[model samples]
Target: MPGIDECLLEVMRLPGARGAAVVDWTSGLALGTIGESPNGDHEATAAETAEVARMAAEQPVFAGDAAVAGPGTRTPGAVPPHPPGLPGLAVEDVIITTAPGYHILRFVETSFDSSVFLHLWLDRAEGNLALARMRLGDIAERLVLA
Candidate 1:
């Protein structure tokens, strides 16, 4: 089990890894980040990745299209009825395409109440998608962010 900093270092050890960030899906915030990219801002990149997770969690289809019980539906621990399946939502990982690279976001289930995720940026030209996915899965299991 490794901490956030060590996890980022391990991700960088993967071949072709450019940059990495740990984001909180619920709040669209970066918990930690490593490396750098020539493509402008890292915080913004992390923020967008968090947004992606938030959007996925909010999709009606994923929640079985049941009408949410309230005006403003909230995620877990927000004083509203729990979003169906969210307590058990199992996202292995997510991959998105960029103009110059591929973004891999791996959700990590931690001991804490909030969900955390790892965001990795890789150069498409140099990255192996399949291998990256496998490695991210392994890393997620090994993560012990207490």
Candidate 2:
């Protein structure tokens, strides 16, 4: 398994990859980063992305299995009047695409309840979304936070 720096470097190998970062979504903080940031400020980018990830993860609508979040997950419980019962969820990744680029946020599976993910930004012209998504999945599983 590779650590943050190495995993990020591997992510950059994907075609059209412009920047990458290992972010702790719980705190909107970057553990490690490389290449250019989506907004030129890695800190701001990390914080912005965290909100997206958090919104998705925190919503019970996305829950495949509550157990999937596990014990250490910082996810505060979600509440909505409409749905009487919600199933637990297993979120593989979150992808946001635009005319110029794509941002993929693949959640890292860790031993502890983790709120971390790998953020990869790629240019739409040269990037392959499917391949990038697949590769990011592999990289997420192999990422070793310690």
lDDT of 1 by residue, 1-146 (tens): 78888888999988889998888887777788899843567778777888887776556444522356544454654433434334544355678887778888887765566578888898888888889888987887678876
Q: How many clashes in candidate 2?
A: 7
Q: How accurate locally is residue 96 in candidate 2, as Cα lDDT from 0 to 100?
A: 98
* Best candidate according to lDDT: 2
Give the per-residue lDDT of model 2 (tens digit) for 21-128.
Answer: 999999999999999997899999999999999888777666653454454553455532222222222567899999899999998877777889899999999999
Residue pairs with clashing backbones, model 1: none
Most accurate candidate by TM-score: 2
Deviation of model 2 at 109, angstroms? 0.7
**Positional deviation of 116 in candidate 2, in angstroms?**
0.4
TM-score, model 1 to reference: 0.75
